[model samples]
Target: MAITKDTFKHVDYLWDDEKAKALGDDQVALLLYRSNILGADLRITNYGGGNTSCKTIEKDPLTKEDTEIMWIKGSGGDIGTLKRSGLAGLYMDKLLALKNVYRGLEFEDEMVALFNHCIYDLDSKAPSIDTPLHAVLPFKHIDHLHPDAAIAIAAAKDGEKITNELFEGQIAWVPWQRPGFDLALQLDKALKANPGIRGIMLGGHGLFTWGDTAYECYINSLEVIDKASQYLEDNYGKDRPVFGGQKVASLPEDERREQASIIAPHLRGLASSYNRMVGHFSDDERVLEFINSNDLEKLAPLGTSCPDHFLRTKIRPLVLEIAPDTDLSDMTEVKAYLEKEFEDYRQYYTKYYEDHKRDNSPGIRDSNPVVILWPGVGMFSYAKNKQTARVASEFYTNAINVMKGAEAVSSYVSLPLQEAFDIEYWLLEEAKLQRMPKEQPLSRKVAFVTGGAGGIGKAIADKLAQEGACVFITDINKDNLDTALATYGKDTGSGALMDVTKMEDIEKALKAACLKFGGVDIIVNCAGLAISKPIAQTTEKDWDILQSVLVKGQFAVSKVAVAILRAQDKGGDIVNIASKNALVSGPNNVGYGTAKAAQVHMSRLLAAELGPDKIRVNVVNPDAVIEGSKIWEGEWAKGRAKAYGITVEELPAFYAKRTIMNEIISVDDIANGVFAFVGGHLSKSTGNILNVDGGVAAAFVR
Candidate 1:
């Protein structure tokens, strides 16, 4: 058939024949190539939502005879990220024979265990529940994708009629059936009856297509999805604005961000009550359009039609009621209203569990909703970590597209409540949950580290990241900051430039951190400056710069960061990196020592004032961290060496000799002090000081 530029309106054509030919004749290699490209585009399929497979001829080890083997995506991985090890391989002859042992629909689940007997590769990953769907199909190459446009057509009230009319008999429609052996048998039957059809829409589920070659299968999948998307795009907004026109105006961008900073933490706390959850925020134009739409209240609670979205976003999102341009300036008022809604959502979810639960059903999972929507602010998705939370938000965006398409041509329809309940409490899903590893101590926590590219700060960031905290780092040096971020890796939240003494810079950085990972739970004030000069030699400029960076910087960071912590209502940590000189009386250290002293007292004061809020404040004093410290890179080191009556190179040993233990202190040692204060080890200890100066007797607090 003829193709035009407009043919792929919602999705893109990514296949390259040269690249495919470069892959040689390896069928599995070709399948992986196709799966990765298809999964790479959200318009084509959501993460981990679909499966692909190909039946290949391989020699059986037992009989040394050519046998058919099917390779499909494993039980738990995104196709975009799939590797060779992520595919499950089974002997096609054995898989097809399982039909003989299957009793009926009542015993479909038992058939899953029998799949192990069909394994062609001993090291292959556990097969997906959808394995049967691919195994039973007769096509050499098959694609089962959860595309928003196709699912939109499948979820309309008269989806079957629409399918017959839109595709003109090229694509067939099948009634919704749960994914398992029974669905496999039904799909086989449907394909048998309509041998001429190129694809089938599983009502309210997804789309399926096939071809003899991998390239043909890929093209067919794209053409079918693109066609459905084009039809929906043409129909949508033609009659009226999508979602029945916007009922509420979106808040200005600045106001929307401020509102997210104020409200995300409370919602995060609610999501974490069952288990601490990391958060992700989205204000994409589409997300805002849907959240502010007149039909938001009507459509959000109907739940998603696709199973992937239902699982990721929960059965229904917790939608808040707020009139357009609501006054959200007062956090106290917003908190009161939010608490009421949060509790109500929990009660409603628990009631849903009690309403539909069977005797053998797993006890209700976290009652808190995974996806929460506020009219003007946008969407907040909370999950085990940043990646999961981000994917959850993306899945909801896909659902929004599906809803728009369905509502455009016909009324949008969701699955029966019973079907949603069954999927939610599925034993197979619980088994997958059981297989996950235990979470780290700080798995769901987020840390904002100031001066994070320097010695103490970088060490602390690395340590926190190792413990599974998503850390957002800030450094004034662009080169250092970029290098630090590269070293930290992507799983660690992210970073931005900030000069802590500048309010605008601090506000911008804090806002970025909040938007990046919802909000901050740990604050590390590690930015510092040193001006070690005798009273006669010290200049006013030296004192001012030292105080501005060391004392005022910490204060400004706390003033902004504390607001985020208190808003989250989750107890937090604030570790002030001071120095041994804070408590010790030393010559040539007037300016630096005074700033350190102020930082120490400021932390104690904050600890006292914030105790009621459960925000712990503490201090870590490290002396002679000369190896990697930026402070030792300039005049300060020379100034200290002169006062100690030693060469610059001997200053390290001099400081070690001054300590009781006579040992050098390192950056990692200071990092340990910060961790001890915040790692739940000193849960009740606050307003205290830990000295990492090899037992500095003079620095010990009275």
Candidate 2:
């Protein structure tokens, strides 16, 4: 707690006075400190939902005299990640001046554009729409949070009465009003009526709290939220029914996950009809209680209460209806049923849009539901990418908490449909949507790279990730796998130990990749070794090893990838890394060349076999990639150098000189070749070989 705490059953007191003292005189810094502490707890606020601000005295640049300025959280940023740069600073005089021109409620949106004129710091981040809430308040420090506990009280049928009795009129209640100038004016009027209230519950919305000092504001926010949480928990005792009691028992934990994975890709395909999307699955305990509850049919259709959650998750979730404990053993039937539900959802959304479209409303967006509820499994959230999908899931979780709290205390309520439609299609919200950067080519795609520890594999993984694909890299080298994962980033990729030749290892790695990201859209088989020896010198073991690692390894990885792709019903890409030797023959390279040839044919065979299923297989032939190559680790480089009558140091030059273009091949060249096949350029051209040899005439397809 920043100031006071007797005890809080639902939240912890984390404020350190010593830390606040060290931040001396920097009111904005104190504001950030307050924002971060509240944001750290999901119970207090949702991601990117709440806003905070402080009005502080600072020397004005032009006047060279003490002047008041307001520092508040900017548009489209999370308070937890707030920084000095993220806070939009405006002159208090200019901002207060805005009240003079304030028109009635119908013109509230026009006031938002005027905020730019009030800004004193041109380089500061743009102010959020909620700026009016913080600016119009009388207190020096203010917080506008979407705490589930407070929203529970805000959303209950008897919210206003409950607010009066719960806090002795210390916390007031303002009925639901869309956030803008009008809401700010309403709050200001409410404060004037009740001179000493600490906070107010924004009906069907969230909580607002303020204090004279930064520390007091932070403490006040926690005390109000914690007290409300404690009240809800005390009234909603253990024996009380949650979500009108469970409708059906949960499936076993392992079974739930297994079913979720098997069903995710189909759901992804449906969601991606208008724009591609990555998915996130959550089986959190609380989510289960609600999804498996009897009241879901009655409550789910009412939709989420918070505006933030509604914007991302849509007006309501799409429910996959089936009798309780319906058999999902056959995914084909489940997928068909889901398809029917999806169509009905789209039709309903279109009707809602038609019912509310104004003359200036932006065109209808994708009709797909962002959130889906499956009774026996869990929740599935979809977005343009993984982090967004995960965040959408989290916001829905907050909505769940609010619903549960409200149901326990009073009848849970949702915002009226007209109010929600206005917020969702507001011209301001549409403008913000237009400002988002264009999606990358591989925005919602995922890649699986085998032997990612090697130079070529790592280069390919990096390229895909740069093009905006999430990668899952696996290698037999544990240390190298860890290093590769570090570079790929936590959001971009995951790592695992895998030997392609081992069936069990391949299965484990595939499962791990599916668990990290939903599934793979592209597969890169780059794992191998080169064993160059004359027929007389090559032993049976040498030949066996080469074939086992190169030919059989690629086959095994492809087998699992095809299964996943089929389950998704989404066509995929398989790129096999072969070599120029596969086309051009050479002496003392029998074993290595034979394996490469098989790898080449394997690509073509699979391409032909999987073409009907929309899976494309292609090959990239690289010649003499020595630097950072796992195949050239020990004797392979020396043997090639010896055969060419050059030192190992000169092998690169020798190989380069042999090419028609006299250029050397690098891992990046091979990576570009792989990109060429799968990076949407030649997406239609498969069962083909891309030679990255700087022009090897002998290896010409003709």
lDDT of model 1 at position 317 = 93
**Total residue pair clashes for candidate 2:** 0
Per-candidate clash tally:
0, 0
Instruction: Give one digit per residue, the lDDT tens place, for model 2 in 628-654.
Output: 778888899888887777899999999
Q: Which stretches of candidate 1 lie over 4 Å from their true place?
A: 1-7, 488-491, 649-664, 694-697, 700-702
**Superposed Cα deviation of residue 617, candidate 1 (Å):** 1.5
TM-score of every candidate relative to the true structure: 0.95, 0.94
* lDDT tens readout by residue for model 1, 523-574: 9999887888888888999889899999999999999989878777788999
lDDT of each: 0.88, 0.87
